[model samples]
Target: MSSLSMASRNLRRRKARTILTVSGIVVGVALIMVLLALTEGTATQTNGLIREILPAQVTIVNATTPTGSGAGIRALFSSGYNLNQSTVAEIAGLGGVYAATGQLSSTAYLNGQTVLLAGIDPSSYPLATNGLSIQSGTSLSTAPSDQVVISDTLAGQLSISVGSRVTLGPNSTGGAPYTVVGTFSSSTTFLDRSVYIPLSNAQGIAGEQGKVSEVYVKVVPQENASTVAAEIQDKVAGVRVVTSTNIATAVSSLTGTLTTVFAVIGFVALLAGGFGVANTMIMSVAERTREIGTLKAIGARSSQVLKIFIGEAFLIGVVGGAAGVAIGAATSLLLSSLGGGAGAGGLGRGARLFSGVLAPAITPELVLLSLALGIGVGVVAGIYPAWRASRMDPAEALRHV
Candidate 1:
């Protein structure tokens, strides 16, 4: 019989133990696959959202905060100091500037739940943001009316619709009621959580009258966005300007940290599986000492004996890796399905936002990588045990029996 055939027969002799060892490897590989899938999904979605949401060429904020540190609207408004509304006109008048708009942002309470609020000028907001996509009812009219537009995501969360009367303020008390004029869809959970009202009302609510939280600027088609952003930074001494590149880098930094952390955890689990494989191989070699001596006495070379043990380890790795991939893929699909139900009631706002956007991506490269890991671990773990079995003296091994 060939060395591989002998190895296969030997493994079948202890089927239960071989299965237990393979199961350890499967657990580790599956865990790594799941982590990679989640990170890949998040990175893909975030890149697409960055392009869709921040179409403006340049965004201006107070210089006190770091550039690109607050790429999201909520972070930008909450951290930066206010700039006077006149700054909008100054930026608009600059060379290569097509238009500019000021926005006021603040936190408001709605039925005891914290809500993000933004005040925008209907005419100018359209010029800067290209206007909100209204799913139902009409967007805010040009006049500063006491009407509010909500994000469809928030509307679903609050269980309110257009023409629904709701009250919002800095606190739970003494707030005026406004009618929901429309619901808009921004296609991202981050921006979709905000409630929009006239800029005048937002300014009044935020208590920063005559000042705006951030400025969005549209550059002329013929001009370079980088050049315009640089000019704005040089001329406007108290403002920080950020372009698309800066925002993308900032967002990547946040997700990159999470990816690194998860990768480390997965690797550690794989190492533990390796140790289990090594232990199992050692015990198998010890139990088979007499059989190995008989093979050597019957004219089998040491090299052949070594191949028999290593082949067994190779088989275990193949089976474990294949099983791990299937289990990991199935688990990722389950998570994606659960995540899709984010709009359902009973979840907290933070949980809803994360689940709403989370999608686990299982790519072919990820599956191959996970398989390679399992095989590599098994081979490395078996080396010592296989070597000890090969170098054994026939006389000593026969005595051991």
Candidate 2:
């Protein structure tokens, strides 16, 4: 019989032991697959959200000297820079500029719950390009005074609908009452938790009349975004100009780190599983000592003996990896489905984290990598045992009890 067939027959003869070895591999491979699926899903969702929110646009924020070394620290404490209507006008007038608008933001209590309040010039807002779709009622127009547009998620949280009046600010006492004129839908998690009002109203409420927190600029088609960004930086001094590519890169870096952390965890599990396989193979070599000696005496070369053992290990890896993939995929899907509704209670930070991982994305690379990992573990685990079987002294092994 062929080496592969012989290896198959040997494993069949010890079905219980073989199954146990395969089970260990299955568990490890399954864990790896699950972790990879979640990591990939999270990265994909985050990148997509970033692109949806900041596509083809440049964001300008107040520039500040870094008080600390890290970007995070600088972002957290940056102050003293503001964008006014004149800056917005100048950016709009720049060559290759499609649209420019300024936004004012603040934290306010809405219907007894704190929510992100964003003020934008309705006439200049890039609604369509920014992926904000009005799901119900009329959008804020130039006539906006007390009219507001809220996200579907915010609507659910506050139990308010279009035409529903809601109180804003601290205990609903800080700003004039506003009427909900529209509800918008956005795929982004953060944006979905925000309420939008006319820039004039927002400025009035925040006591920052004639000032905006940031400016968003959209470049005309067929123009280089980087070039425009540099120009904007030169023209608009005392502000930070961030292009869409910069935002995407930052998002990608964050997700890449998260993926690496989970990958390390999965690798550790797989390493443990490799040890289990090695132990099982070593025991198998001991049990088959006599058989190996007889085969060598009967014309089986050392190479053939090694192939037999490696083939057996490889078969185990194949079976275990396939089974693990199926189980892992099912488990991930189930968990994602359950986690998708976690934001129903509120749009708090915890809810956003959970809601972001709404589904596990299974990619071809993930499947192939999982299969390769399992087989690689099996092959590495079998090496010493296979070598031991191949070097067995025929005369001595034949006398093994």
Candidate 3:
């Protein structure tokens, strides 16, 4: 029989031992694969999603200090600081602004239901939120319908739809009603659970006549977005400036920490798997001493014997590595599902819960890492076994079996 075929037969002779060993190695490799994949994917997506939502020219808010500069430290403690209307107007009037929309935000609730309400100028809406889409029914116009746009998830949550009249509550007066004129399906968390109405409507309902909370300024040329933003930060008051890149950087730091912890854990598992492989190979050598002696007696070279043992170890490793990768992915997927399937359901927004970020995903990088790790473990496991096999003496080994 060929060397490979003979080796296969020999391994089959101890099926239970081989299986147990492979299982141990597989579990270890799988954990490593899943961890690495998740880290890499998170870093990549965080940067991308941040850019999409907060483009270069965009500005964001955070709590600030009395000195004017971003409360770089204060932001960590609290948020919900308001951006001024006059400052927004000035920025909009800046030489290169294509459009500027004011954001009036508040933690709004319907009796027992707590939700978020985002106020934007209907006339300048497209400049701020990308665009308001009407998934069903008609688009809401600024006019004076007290009409509001709702998201699909929100619609489902409130059991209200087009033409449904919902009480928006006291226009700082005690009670007022804003009609739900349209329903939209923008996957964003703000929109999903949002009650979007004209900045005028929100102002009137909240008992405030002409005040704004946040400002979204789009550059006239789009290319001068960054330059315009710097001008705003230098001149605007009561506003902490942020862009999509800033959000990406902040979130990436958090995810990076988690990724590092998981990688270290995966390394430990791989180390343990390596030890298991070594023990199994060593045991196989001791058990098959007599067989090895017979082969030597029949003129098999020491190098050949070493090759055979090492070959068996490599096969085990390949199998284990593949299995480990599969397992790691499964674990990640399970965790993701439990955490709400990457949904926009967190409460980090300025008085609003924008589900802008989701959990990390499994990817090809994870699979490759697992396989490479498995191979490394297999080689280590076979070293001693191969050495003993190569050093065997036919005369002495004949008595071993």
Candidate 4:
């Protein structure tokens, strides 16, 4: 019989042992796959959230004060520093600039509850955010003054809706009453807790009429963002500039570190599986000592004997890897489904914060990589056992039986 045929027959004779050995590999590979999927999903979701909420490619803020690294999204409610409103027109007139708008962020109270308030220009602000996407009633353009658009999460919290009259001002007890002309929904907490009003109204309310918290600028199509950001920093005095590339690089650095940590964990689990495979192969060699002697006496070369045992290990790797891929993919999808479902159908701001569910991304590369790792572990584990079986003397192996 050929070496492959002999390998197949030997494995079939020890079905229980073969199955147990493969199971170890399957578990290890599956764990690695799931970890990779989760990390990939999180990175993708975070980047998408950044783009959706802050669509502008370049952001300008006051250099005198510290702000969120990119566009001050995390500093959404802070009013510590301000930039001149005329800076918007100056940046807009610059070369390679497509659009520019200014915004003022501050705190407002709604019936004793603190909320984030944003003042945006009705015309130019929509260009930066791709429109606030009002879910009900009219936008700020329709009722520019004394009208506000509230997020669905905020709307649900205070039991307010479109056309409902609400009071918002510096304090809870004393404030100006404004009609809620529109309502909007956002999957991210950054936008969910916010209430949007006209730039003029926000300035009046915050007592910073000629100042804006930050400026959002869109680069002209086919223009380089880094170049524009550099120009903005140079031309605009006392202002800090952030570009989309900077944000992406910062995000990548964080995710790369996270991926490395997960990879080490997965590799450790897979290493344990390799040890199990080695032990199984060693035991098999011990049990088949006499059979191997018989084969050697029948003119089978040591090299041929080695090939047969290695072939069996290869088969085990292939089967285990395939099975592991299926299990891992299914488990990832199940967890994603459960996580996504849990965040829905709940009321209030906390629920809304958890509503942005990121599903696991299972790419073809991940599957192939996992399968390759399993196979490699199996082959490496079998090396010593295969070598020992090949180098054994016929008389020495046969005398034991």
Q: Which ranges of candidate 4 are over 4 A from the true structure?
A: 1-28, 67-73, 156-159, 172-174, 294-308, 311-359, 390-393
Please count the clashing residue pairs in each candidate, in the order shown: 0, 0, 6, 0
Candidate 1 TM-score, C-alpha based: 0.77
Per-prediction TM-score: 0.77, 0.81, 0.83, 0.79
Give the runs in model 2 whose Cα sits over 4 Å from its true position.
Answer: 1-28, 52-56, 65-81, 127-131, 173-175, 268-272, 295-307, 323-347, 350-360, 387-393
lDDT per residue, candidate 1, 98-213, as tens digits?
A: 88999887778765567778889888988886578899899999987889999897888889999999987778786878899999986865565688899989888888888887
Writing each residue's lDDT as its tens digit, candidate 3 over 90-208 gives: 77777887887776666465433555676777777676556656788866686756777777787887798888877665333335566787887755443456677777767765555
Candidate of highest TM-score = 3
Instruction: Please give the distance, in angstroms, between residue 369's alpha carbon in candidate 1 and its true position after superposition.
Output: 2.2
| C-alpha lDDT of residue 108 in model 2 | 64
- Model 3 misplaced stretches (Cα beyond 4 Å): 2-20, 47-57, 62-80, 110-112, 170-174, 188-190, 207-209, 220-224, 341-358, 399-401
The global C-alpha lDDT for each of the candidates, from Candidate 1 onward, is 0.79, 0.74, 0.68, 0.78
Question: Candidate 4, residue 174: CA error in Å?
Answer: 5.5
Error of 3 at 62 (Å): 5.7
User: What is the per-residue lDDT of model 2 for residues 227-296, given as tens digits with 9 covering 90 to 100?
Assistant: 8888999987787787666755665565566567767876787787788789988999999899999999
List model 4 lDDT by residue over 235-338, tens digit each.
99999887666656655555566567767877887788788888988899989999889989988899998998888787778777888888889988987665
